[model samples]
Target chain A: MATATVILLDGLAYGMVLFIISVGLTVTMGLMRVVNLAHGGFAMAGGYLAAMMIRAGVPFFAAAALATLAAGILGGIAEMTVFRPLYRKGELAQVLMTFGLTFVFIAALTWLFGTDVKILPIPSYLAGPVDLGFRTYPTYRLFLIVVGLLLFLLVWFVIEGSLYGARLRAAVDNPRMARAVGIDVNRLFTITFVIGCALAGFGGVIGAEMLQLDPFYALRYLVLFLVVVAVGGLGSFKGSFVAAITLGVVETAGKFLFTDIAAFLLFALVFVLLLWRPNGLLPPKSVA
Target chain B: MNPAWHALPWLLAIAFYFTAGGYLSLGTSILVYILLTLSLDLALGYAGIITLGHAAFFGFGAYGAALFAIHVNADPLLGLVVATAVTAVFAVVTGMLILHTQGVTLLMLTLAIAVLLAEAANRAYKVTGGDDGLQFTMGPVLGLFRFDLWGQTAYLYTLVILFVWFVIAWKVVHSPFGRSLDGIRQSQARMRAIGTPVWWRLIAIYAISAAMAGSAGALSAQTTRFVGLNTLGLLVSGIAVVMLVLGGTRRLYGAFLGAAVYVVVQDFAAKVNPFYWMFVIGGLLMATVLFLEGGLMEVLDIGRRWLRRLLRGSDPT
Candidate 1:
């Protein structure tokens, strides 16, 4: 029972971090049809920025927020210069270009802040365990779970409820039609891209405690983020949330049960799941 | 094809034999990449399958050859054959599962398969030697030439294999089967409408490409007498793609050209500043996508055309 509880708590926290990091990729891939392999580069940048700020004595929360904003701004710049030109290219071109961008980011980060791994300093208040009614749990993990749920709700409300959400959906479904209806699709793409990148940065800073912050961080966890997006079905917010949590739990359980073949077991699970649903667990309603 | 073009690879090989006396190993490495990129061209350029996990086959072949040489016979030819067979089987099994999905899903599946294999190799250190990799000396080529320290025999052996594979690839790309692949690439639905077995064709091409990549991997292991985890790494797969795109896709000879250019440039840059070589590669890749549409082949073709025109004008013919 104790093992199960610990696994559940740890899995939830891990899943929440995965969701926060991968959600941005899902949105961009769905809307832009661009395989932005460099999405993790933004996360890496945010992580380093947050780590540096925290080391400089700023509060963790404030540093994270500032780092996210910085990431958003950097995303805006990249979208205008690099990504805008690639919107019309084929998937192959997009893959190559974004891949190159990832290399550049990795090299630049290595040059800026040596190759050593940098850990995010968690505040003392959020470090220790908190007493739950049934059991005691780490405060930081509980905080992560709560934050993840809150972000999910906020994102869900904004994407599924608001008028802006409708416009974004319209633009994603048919950019020409959306433009014909005066929806300003180009502007919509810009805003959506920024938001997606910002989310990645925010996730990077917060999830750094679990995922680790380093120069190779971008490429190391790229496949995991991609797995979440692929299994969740590109462009589906709820799908990503569910997939992330499921993967996290499965990964945690696999590690506990089978130490050596945990990665193999996780991949096998994903493979079986993918075989069953080639399009993903929950495909979008309107196919592109 | 022009006679000059037919003799190009051989002429280049001979030229390198004399000029690459010091960098013979680098030359051999380039030949290996040519084989790998050629296999990629078969899949991505002709079959239009967007795969990022090709290194899986390469790594499998390398490990298979290394294990075979260590446990069974040390003959290079036998090792290559065994490696190719192993990778072909692996490709067929995985291709059936992955080729069903197209676009991003296919890419994800391919990457997943490779990563799984890499992780498995990493964990099964008892067999694979973990991250440290497996090392084993290979017997002489054709049971006549002995393995040497200067890599002279290895270079010649690799050159012969590369030439043979080039002929096979060239023949495959020009045959009716190759034309069918082009049709499938242009429009899978159209190919299916025309009663072509699109899935079987893809499976066949993928297996064939895997075999070729496996041969390259086997050759690497035989020559270097070492097989590391990086053999199956994502970076290897990505570099293959970059090399293929750098030369030009769909054109068989582009593989050689791209591999040559990429290897030479990388070697030079690494020697100059290993730390920033990635930046150079990244810049080149981005520039290729943004500016060079048809790759280095197209530029060379333009230059050749211009030179011919200039010669004709001067000759008054």
Candidate 2:
């Protein structure tokens, strides 16, 4: 029971990080209809930026905030310069271009910050174990869980409750029709893209401790983020959240229980899940 | 297609032996890439199946052949056969499961399968030697030529295999089955309307392509006498795609042209600065997608047309 509890907490923390990172991708993929394989590049940029700031004796929180903003600006520039031109092109072009962009980012990062893994200097307060009534848990993990929940609620409120989200939804549903209705889809896309990138950057800053900041971080964890987005059903925020947590727990538990065949079991589980639901776990209602 | 095009690969192969005999290993590496990219063309170019994890089959074949040689027999030909068979089975099973999906979902599925295999290989270090990879000596080629350090025999052996497989691919693509695949690529709905067994055809071609890729992997393992986990890496899959795209897809010769250009450029750039060759590759990919629509083949075709018009004294349009 004790082991299970520990596993559950660790899995939740891991899943929360995944959710924070992947939710941005899910939104952008849905809104833009572009694969954006370079999404992880933005996260890497944020992580690296935060690492640099913290090394310069800045507080972690302030550094993270600045990194998020910088990542968003970079994302905006990319969307305008690189991605905008390819929106009219096919998905293949988008994929190829983004993939190339990923390489460029990876190479650039490697040149700047050598290949060694960069660990974020966690604050002393967050480094120690905190005593819960029944069990002692790492403070940083608890912090991650809290942040993930707050971000989830914030995203849910923005997407489901706000007027801006309504417009975003309208644009997603029918870009042509939304434009005809004077929704300014291009502006809407730009806004959503920036927000998505900012969220990814924020996730990177927070999850840096957990996921490790490295030059290869973008490519290494790309598949996990993609899996969450794909399995969650594109454009569905709730679906992404649920899928991320579920995959996180399952993967963590599988690794813990089956040391030898953990990967095999995880993939088999994904295959089964995908086979059972080809469209994804929670496909949009309009499709049916 | 021009008759000269059919003779291009052969001419190039012969030219390399006489002119660049010192770089036989590089030549052999290019040939392996050609086979791999050609297999990719069979799926992506012909069948219009966008896969990002083709290295799964390639790595499987490499490991299978290496393990077979270490445990059972070292005969390169028989190992190639066994490797091809193993990958064919893997492809059939995976293809059946993954072919039902389309677009990004299919791409993710393929990537996942490859990653899964790579992780499995990493964990099964007892058999695979883990990250260090499996190193084993290969026996003589067809009981005739011995594997050498200069890679002369390896080059010729790879060239022959590549030539043979190229012919098979050429025949397959030109056949009615091949035309149906083109039809599917163009419009799956139209093919289905016309009574084509689209799913079955995709599965069949995927398996065939997997077998071809397996042979390429087996060839690499045999020639290099080393098989590493990177064989199944995303980088390999990505490079194969880049090569296919650069050479131009659908055209069989494009695989050769693309592999040659990419490998040669990579060799040169890596020699210059091993750490930053990715910049060159990435820049090239961007230029290809943005400026060159149909890749180098199309550019060459355009140049040929211009030359013909100039020779005829006709005003170029």
Candidate 3:
């Protein structure tokens, strides 16, 4: 019972982090039909940025904010430079181009950082564990859960309850019709790309401690995050949240229970899910 | 012009293979990629399958053949058979699932499948020799020819396999079935409307492509004497696609020429400056996407055309 509770909490925390990392990829793929393989590069850029700032003696929160904003800007640039041109190409070209971008980003990053693993220092305020009758869990982990939930709700509000989201939805549902109706799709693509990268950036800063920084860290984690998107079904933010959490639980439990099994069983699970439902567990109704 | 004059390209490739000093291994690598790329070209460029993870089959071929050689002590030829069988089975299983979707969903499914295979290879350290990769101790070609340390037998063997596949691919591309595939690539719905079983054609093409990829994998393992997780990684898949695109995807011989160019560039560039090789490749890719559009083969064709025009300028009106 005690282990179950611990697993549940850890699973939720891990899931939230996965959701944050993958939500951007979901949006870009869904809205733009661009398989941005470099989506994880944005996360890496954000994490590295925050780490650089923190190392320079800036406050942690301020460093994280700056990093997130920079990631958003970088995302906007990527939108303008890369994806816009690719929007007209076939799926293979887009996949290859984005995958090429990932290679460039990774090679450049490794050249710059020298392949040393950087550890983010957990703030002093959140170092200790909070008492919970059966077991004490780290406060920082709980904080991550809270932040993830808040972001989830925030994205939900923006996507579901806002006029901007309505316009984006209309564009996704029928780009030609939306253009006929006077909605600017090009601008929406840029905005959606930026927002998606911002989410990934946030995940980078917050989850840096969890995902210890390494040269190919983005590449290593990319498949996992993509699995979340795949399992959840692309284009549905809510589906991503649910899928991410489910994958987190399954992966975490697999780590604990089947130490002898290959680590990729979790990925195999996603592969099976994809086979079962090619569009994912909850495919988006709209296609821009 | 005599019809036999059109065979000039094959004659040239054979001459290059025989006499292109210090290019035997590089030529062989190109042949391997030509086979791999042509296999992919059949499915993706011709059939419009959009398989983003085709390297999985290639890796499966390498690993399966390597394992068969190591454990079953099978002949290299038999190992190729086993590899194809395994890859075909895997393709049928994954293709059935992946082919259900259209567009981006298909792309993601392919990526996911490849990543899963790579991850499995990574995690199964003992089985796959882990990051160190799987090394092979092989006998020879068909139990007759020995694998020379200098890669002589490997080169000739790879060339023969490549030529055979190329001829097969060539014949198929010009056949009725091949035209049907092109029709499907243009519009699947229309093909179905015209009484073609679009799905079955796709499965058949995917199976054939898997067999080709597996053949390359077997040949690569036989020649290179090693197979690693990198075989299934995104890098391999991405590079294959890059090579295909660089060659002129829609053209039959484009993949071959593209593979040759890509391998040569990698070899010479890394020798020139290892530190800047990636940057150069990235820049080349960016340039290719932006300007050439038709790939390196197209560039060569244009240059050849210009050269002929220049030579004829004063002689002809």
Candidate 4:
């Protein structure tokens, strides 16, 4: 019973982090039809920036916020400049270019901060244990759950309830028709891409403890993020939410139960699931 | 135009032997990289198999050779044959399972194979030496020319093997089967409509490419006497892609130029700072994809055309 509870809470926290990091990749892939392999680079950028700021005497939360915003700005600039040309290119070019960008990001990070791992220290309030009615838990885990749920709701409201959400959905379903119906799909992509980048950055700063922050952070955790996106289906936000949770629980369970073969099992599961549903569990109507 | 030009690279290798006092091993590794890239071109450039996990076979080849040396026989030739055979068989089985899937799924599956193999190797530490890497000494080639302290035998041995593979690759690219592969690359459906067994053909080429890659891996292990876990890493596969792309895919000699340039640049870049290599390679990759689509080969072709026109003093129609 104790193990179950621990696994559940930890898995939920991990799932939230995965969702926050990978949702952007799914969105950008769906929107641009380009495999942006450098998406993790933005996440790493945010983590490194936050680490730098925190080390320079800024409060942790403020540093995280600033870093998230900076990541968004960086993403926007990248989308406008480097990513713009990719829209018309083939998959080969897209993969090659984005993968190249990842190397550059790693190089820059290494040049700036050396290759040592950096950690983001949580405040005392968040670091301490909190008493649940049934059991005691770390305050940080609970905080992650709350923050993740709130962010989910906010994203849900934006993507489902708002008029902008309708337009975005239309664009995702069928971009040509969406444009024919007077929706500015390009601008929609930019807005959504920026928001997605910010979310990844936010995830980076918060999830750094579990994922770790180093020069190779971008490429190191790439497989995990890509798996989340793949399992969740490329274009579905709610799908990513569910997939992240499931993968988190399965991974956490595997870690405790089958220590050596956990990664192998997870990758094998991806292959099986893909074979079962090539389009993913929850695919959009007309995936480009 | 001149058949004599074919021997130029071999000539350079023979000259490099005496002149390059301390860099023979570097030359040997360059030959290995060249072989790896050439194998990748056969699949990626010719057959349109977009894989990111070619390093898996390379790693398998290395492990197979290393283990064979340690346990079975220390004969280099026997180990090479065993390693290549095992890698090709593995590729055959994997290709059967994965060649049906196209696009994103195919890409992910290929990557998964490499990751799973790496993980498996990491866990079986006793055999693989885990992250510490596997080290083994082997008998000299045919018990004749021993691996010398100066690495002269290793360089010559690798060069001869590279030349053999290069000839094979050249012949394979110009053959009927290679043309069929080109058709499949252009349109798998069209090839299928014409009674071509698309999946089986892919499997065949994949096995051949794997065999070549495995041979390179075996060569690396035999020459260096060590196999690092990084032989199976995504970085190695990514570097192969960069090298092949840089040299120009579809052009047989691209691997030679790409490997040489990449190694030279990497040597210089690493001297400045360890991280500078990444920036240089990354910048070169982007530039190649965006501007120099045909890679340095296109530039060379244009130069050749200009030179011919200049000498002839007229349009060379």
lDDT of each: 0.89, 0.88, 0.81, 0.88
- 1 or 3, which is superior by TM-score? 1
Those runs of model 3 whose alpha carbons end farther than 4 Å from true positions after fitting are: B1-23, B119-133, B271-275
Q: Which pairs of residues clash in candidate 4, taking residues 3 or more apart in a chain or in different chains?
A: none
Best by lDDT: 1
**Taking the tens digit of each residue's C-alpha lDDT, what string does model 4 give over B1-317?**
45766777779878988999988899999999999999999999899898888999999999999999999999998999999999999999999988987766677778888988898899899989999998889898988988888899999988988899999988998999999999999999999999999999999999999999999999999999999899999888888888998999898778888888999899999999999999998999889888988888888778878887798886565
Q: Output DockQ, candidate 3.
A: 0.47
CAPRI tier of model 2? medium
The best candidate by DockQ is 1
Q: Against the true structure, what is model 1's DockQ? A: 0.72
Q: What lDDT, from 0 to 1, does candidate 1 have?
A: 0.89
Candidate 1, A122: how far from true, in Å? 1.1
Worst 10 residues of 3 chain A by lDDT: A259-268
- List runs of model 1 lying over 4 Å from the truth: A133-135
**What does the lDDT read for residue B162 in candidate 2?**
92
- What does candidate 3 score in Cα RMSD to the true structure? 2.6
For model 4 the TM-score comes to 0.96
Model 4 segments beyond 4 Å from truth? B1-5, B314-317
Candidate 1 clashing pairs?
A: none
Tens digit of lDDT per residue, candidate 3, span B83-107?
8889989888778767857876676
Deviation from native of the Cα of residue A239 in model 3, angstroms: 1.3
Over the true interface, candidate 1 deviates by an RMSD, in Å, of 1.1
Instruction: Kindly give the stretch of ten consecutive residues in candidate 1 chain B with the minimal lDDT sum.
Output: B1-10
List, residue by residue over B1-317, the lDDT tens digit for candidate 2: 67876787798797897788688898999999999999999999899898899999899999999999999999999999999999999999999888978877788788889888998899889999999999999999999889988898899899999988999998999999999999998889999999999999999999999999999999999999999999999988988989999889888878988999999888898888775878788888888888986888888889889887787886554
Candidate 3 local lDDT, A1-288, one digit each (tens): 888888788888888989998989988877777777788889999999888889999888998889889999999998888878888877766766676677677678777877788777778999899998777999999999999999999988988999998988788778999999899988887888898898898899899878777657767788777777767777778888989988888877877777645356676777678767776787778531
